[model samples]
Target: MGLSVENSVTQSHTRTHKTFLITNYMLLGAASACIFLTLSLRLLPSLCGFFLILLHVVTIASAVSGCSIVTSGSNKSYAAHMVAMVLTSIFQGSVSVLILTRTSDFLGYLKSYVREEEGETILKLAGGLCVAVFCLEWVVLGLAFVLRYYAFVEGQSAHPRNERVSEEELKNWPWPFQV
Candidate 1:
């Protein structure tokens, strides 16, 4: 049997964890939709970019909440979620670093293509917004992994391992792998 935290431990953390995932996925879906809106509504690409970054800010905040929740030991599924977050954290961290490293290159690229009078301003504003969000996203996702590790270790030590696998149950699976 796995470690079990007493119900008295409080479930606020699990509630918050679920809330973050729900909000993150919903806002991310909307952001994906907004990106498509740029194809048809052509007042300004920069305006669309700004809103896109705003939506992402919400998503990243949700990620931070998820990270915090992982540290609280409120949910059993935290391990699974953190396992997934590890992959996303790596990807997001790389993206954030790339943006930071290439910010100047990005501004130059913008100057080369965007001839609008305010292109540089938009570049600074919108790119700064995106880079900031990416940076925060990287931080939280990495923290989530660390938090999950501690929770896992703490949980393992807290609960009693009373349940044992029966011979019949063991025989049902391949010898080396039993649930």
Candidate 2:
């Protein structure tokens, strides 16, 4: 009886914590997405550029809540993840190509910051570094989404449980939450 009560309490606490964590992730993702979109649109201010930036927002959304990507409320979703990756990659690729096409103008814009030759070199280096970092972040976000989707499809999901898991299952649960 004591064990049953403890399990019930633990399950409830776990459910509440899961909800809170997910909510925090979603809120932060939405806020950061707004910042990213605003900066991209303001800096580039072109139709294709806007869409490319919007894809970045979608990528963040996927990381925050891949489960929410479902259209029909189903958990099985490897195909959805594939679609997301393809679409995001297309936009990222297009943005890179577009940057290439604007090489002269981009350089001019960079040089505008500081008119010295050294300034131009610095600008080029900084811009390249920023792009590389952004691409790395995008890759990480994609990997996280893929991992989350895989867990969902395999029923190894991060769902908030209404009922207590068996002791065997509890053994597999993450540490600090082990019952």
Candidate 3:
């Protein structure tokens, strides 16, 4: 009877922790997505740029939180989602710097002087890179959302008391749950 009580308490604690951890992950993913969108839309007024920068900061924080969860071995799908967030954050940060610094203008001038055709090619290449990164991020976001959905579904069902897992379970969760 004592063992059963202990097990029940443990299960309850585990369930609470799992939900809390999941909440953190979802929020992180959401914040990362918000940053990506805001930064991508930055234009015109420098104030927008400032907002983008702020968003980037938030993205980094989200990435960190995601990383912590991944390291904790909470859920593989969640880990994978965090990895995506980290990658997106790094790419966004670099891209933001490039855009804000007029790096493109400098590169364009250099290309134009050396080879007009080549300069146009370089411009196209840069644009293509941006598009690719943005598209990839969108894909990641979609995957994250889908994964989160699956997680929600899985958690929606109550587990039999006797079957409570001691170690975190990543089985068939979805997406990058086992990352």
**Most accurate candidate by lDDT:** 3
Residues 1-179 of candidate 3: C-alpha lDDT, one tens digit per residue:
98897678567656555554555555455555544433343332455345444644655465455434433435775766566565655665465456446644634433233344454444344434444444444544554454455445446644554774533575656667555
Writing each residue's lDDT as its tens digit, candidate 1 over 68-107 gives: 4666646655655555445544443443454456655544
lDDT of 2 by residue, 37-98 (tens): 33532445455435544665665655445444432234446456546645654554554454
TM-score of each: 0.39, 0.37, 0.33
Candidate 1 Cα outliers beyond 4 Å, as residue runs: 1-61, 64-68, 72-115, 160-179
Please report, as a residue range, the 10-residue window in candidate 3 with the lowest summed lDDT: 106-115
lDDT of all the models against the reference?
0.48, 0.49, 0.50
**Between candidates 1 and 3, which one is better according to TM-score?**
1
User: What's the residue-level lDDT of 2 in candidate 2?
Assistant: 83
> What clash pairs does model 2 have?
none
Q: How accurate is candidate 2 locally (lDDT)?
A: 0.49
Model 3 pairs whose backbones collide: 76-176, 76-177, 76-178, 77-176, 77-177, 77-178
List the candidate numbers ranked by lDDT, top first.
3, 2, 1
Runs in model 3 deviating more than 4 A are: 1-104, 108-116, 158-179
